[model samples]
Target: VVGYELSNGQRVSKDEGIQMAKIGEIAGVAVATRKGNEYLRSLPDENENNNLGNLPSITD
Candidate 1:
């Protein structure tokens, strides 16, 4: 995903969200690295219905 739309309607870039997550500004997600690229992953839980992949895309 290119970015995320916060609940307050603010759109933040992937890197920005990653930075926020690092400082505990965002919750329920953990920072991960793959092939030298940093990314975000939802914390493991029993809820299968709210995975990040399941969220609707913001086309704007």
Candidate 2:
């Protein structure tokens, strides 16, 4: 994205990685279904990484 911006290519890389992550989540779902039984860590959930519990978003 930065490179495109520099060259004025009109293509954006900004947040493209974020988009790829979503696509990756879909891939993970597919793989988990065909390979074997889904496990806790293999599943996606809101509470999956909430080990610290609800906390502040920005402390600074």
Candidate 3:
């Protein structure tokens, strides 16, 4: 994940940046899926069983 520092000296994940990248990578697949492309839709889920890393603290 991408990150950035805030003015108060705190770090935050750059969700928008990651989302944009994901969208770009999936754009073609999304279009093909919408156009009833069976091959694209048949692709396996790369992160289907992936975990979200360690859990975050409440204060985080």
Cα lDDT listed for each candidate: 0.85, 0.30, 0.35
Off by over 4 Å in 1: none
Worst 10 residues of 1 by lDDT: 48-57
Residue-pair clashes per prediction, in order, are 0, 0, 0
- Best by the TM-score measure: 1
| lDDT (Cα, 0-100) at 31 in candidate 1 | 91
Q: Give per-residue CA lDDT, model 1, range 1-60, as digits (tens).
A: 889876678899999999999999877788999999998888878986666776678997
lDDT for 41 (candidate 2): 18
The lDDT ranking, best first, is 1, 3, 2
Superposed on all Cα atoms, model 3 deviates from the true structure by an RMSD in Å of: 10.9
Better of 1 and 3 by TM-score: 1
Stretches of candidate 2 off by over 4 Å are 1-14, 25-60
How far is 4's C-alpha from truth in model 3 (Å)?
Answer: 0.6
Candidate 3 Cα lDDT to native: 0.35
